[model samples]
Target chain A: MEEVASKVLSTKPTLFSYFRSSASWRVRLVLALKGIEFTYQAVNITKDGGAQQYSEDYAKMNPMNRVPALFIDGKCLGESIAIIEYLEETRPDTRKVFPSDPYLRAKARQLTEIINSGIQPLQNLEVLNKIEDELKGDRKEWAQHFIKKGMNAFEEIIKETRGKYCIGDEVSIADVCLIPQCFAAERFGVDLATFPNIKEIRDSLTGLPEFIAGDLKSQPDYVA
Target chain B: MEEVASKVLSTKPTLFSYFRSSASWRVRLVLALKGIEFTYQAVNITKDGGAQQYSEDYAKMNPMNRVPALFIDGKCLGESIAIIEYLEETRPDTRKVFPSDPYLRAKARQLTEIINSGIQPLQNLEVLNKIEDELKGDRKEWAQHFIKKGMNAFEEIIKETRGKYCIGDEVSIADVCLIPQCFAAERFGVDLATFPNIKEIRDSLTGLPEFIAGDLKSQPDYVA
Candidate 1:
């Protein structure tokens, strides 16, 4: 590692996050599950037109200006799945986010990508606002429409795949992604009742300590 | 593997794809780069409101009902990134989509995720239709806005990282993703001049035979 990179990793790494952002919540759960210590910097994405994230200073760390940028090993990494994979690789001795078998590992990733790429981005706050403002659509209704489509697919896959969690009896990265997405889906008024298979797996995951501590209401930046 | 899945794999693997989908193009590049021969089954995304993909038979094969679903190794995998990773893992001895070094591998995935999750979903035909029909916004304008934002970030990051590809001298997954996205962006009227580094790298990759054969026009489903 470069001297600068080594030094940053040596310190308590900093995580830039928002309290209610599903992407940010996924990262927080990863940090907690891996038992990594980190400082939290709240970038108020909903304030001043989400100005804090787009500021000149913040853009230096993350050009996309998205939250959940983790600074570690001398690099500022953006994208939640990217950051999660980095943590998993660099610290393999820690709790794992994947299975050991390549096929099973691939299956885990397939489930995670279904959310990370498939569902979560569609209902993101920025997209929500764009539709609400430019199209005069109800933001909550727009969110519900997309989330339900995602959950409907998720229900089919998870039914065949779930044992104790999204993959099996163990918690993997897929569960980390599922919890927050399920939370956001319910927040937008999509009844979890629509997805029986997913809701059962989600119910089992929500009570764990790692998940409990990462709850949106428990985060430092949460106002309500 | 199940007996039926094994039988399916015994035949040439099938790619469930669309002629113009950028996500499908990424998978085609990976298949060609690995020298893996596959049969193509086009699921037209623009016909009957994308009804073919959602039909009972197609959904049985892929619950997600998205194109670029790969039938290989006795499994049907949806989501482009997941299929790519599966190919990389199942055939590690083949051409890789990631770097051997862990940190660099993480970086490659970050770039791929930026396109897979960031730009593509926002400009999805479904999302665009929702905006146009419900919000009275121009679909092309919505696509241009999000594509430009993603390309701006991609340009900045690739400037610091590119050599022959999106990482360094070697071709990586990031390159696989960037080439198609740049094409889609240009089609939607985002000027490539604004993203010089990305455009330069994109130009280099497009010349490769692996990419050339996967061009939208080369696919059997292409109209022109």
Candidate 2:
């Protein structure tokens, strides 16, 4: 069963991904939440001398040259938030990723963007690489600073909105975004204890089957 | 009429914004497109010994401490994308920002995120200040690099998706996102002539009153 699950492929819905790319993981979490099956095509972002995402072929798939571009519904889509929202819209019958109320839905998106734009971009491979190249600053330190700042903001907002998750009792798109960032924070050596609400939210969501399915350890290309 | 319009305030969906914050401009674009009247309250991101957004008072309104927090629907919503999405959902009677077609809607959002997450966050005042402080790198050059790279990707996608606007004949959230980034690109000395599709999109959108109302010069606090 492990072998079958690990090597599953054949173009049902293809996800071009790097196993630990949190952006990619966010999409995977949504797919798992929706009970969707997909072919995992690893695009080893850190391998091959210069990040394979920069290749002409990958650029054609996503001109942005980033990962977790889901080739579903007869078209390829990029941007994890957009792809997640698309999945929510198209596969509403399974489990809804967004809340039904318009305000709650917007709040969910706000929390998602806080991580998406606020934290993830600041610490991602590209930006960290840029910092390392341009300033020769401590890349890990840079990542830690921004992650801590963003997490502080996330903690502040979640204090008001969380209820076993980022929005309420239900797991919204915000929770879908939260788990990956919390993983990123820990990987970057951030003390999650400083962010009690976020840590609490992370603790609650990590045990779920959907989130577990998309975690770093579960991916086909994961390396210890 | 000019006097009334310029000082329009007193409990009509307040917007806490900086004139030059592109993120803030995005929400303003949507409001103008929808013809929604909003009371503009400028939060000088560069004033009063630092950004007013960092004040204890303002942080209560927005934990993220960023500009363009909109007070509407009897609640204060931060994160420009969240506020805009909220406006779109509640005020569907106005000029629709997202398309009815699911794929196109996703595409529009994809383009929005490409700017929202990809470009804007990379070049915003906070990130630039970080770059300047840590590396002493030419901040303009840093901004230009990311802006050009993102615009390159945007141009590529729009080449396939362009009509009269980013997705098709009608305007979209993509177009809302496009105009501000174009403004930022030019500010950072990125020659838009290279990205003809984006340039054309910008040219077409800039002529509309909606885009103009949200532009840098249109705000109450324009300095130059």
TM-score of each: 0.95, 0.95
Residue range with the least summed lDDT across 10 consecutive positions in model 1 chain B: B1-10
lDDT of 2 by residue, A89-196 (tens): 888688998989887888888888989999898998888888898688888998998888778888888887889888889988898888889888888899999998
Chain B, TM-score, each prediction? Answer: 0.94, 0.93
Clash pairs for candidate 2: none
Provide all candidates' interface root-mean-square deviations: 1.2, 0.8
Summarize candidate 1's per-residue lDDT along A1-224 as a digit string, tens digits.
12323434557888888999888899999998999988777889999998889988788778999998888877789999999999998998899988777767777887888888888887888888887887677889888877877778888887877898988788988899999998888788888988888888889988999998777878899998
Instruction: Give the candidate number with the greatest lDDT.
Output: 2
Scored by DockQ, the top model is: 2
Query: Which residue runs of candidate 1 sit more than 4 Å off their true CA positions?
Result: A1-10, B1-9
Reference-based lDDT, residue B70, model 2? 85
lDDT of each: 0.84, 0.86
DockQ per candidate = 0.75, 0.82
Question: Compared with the true structure, what per-residue lDDT tens digits does model 1 show for residues B15-40?
Answer: 88897898899999999999999988
Each candidate's fnat: 0.79, 0.88
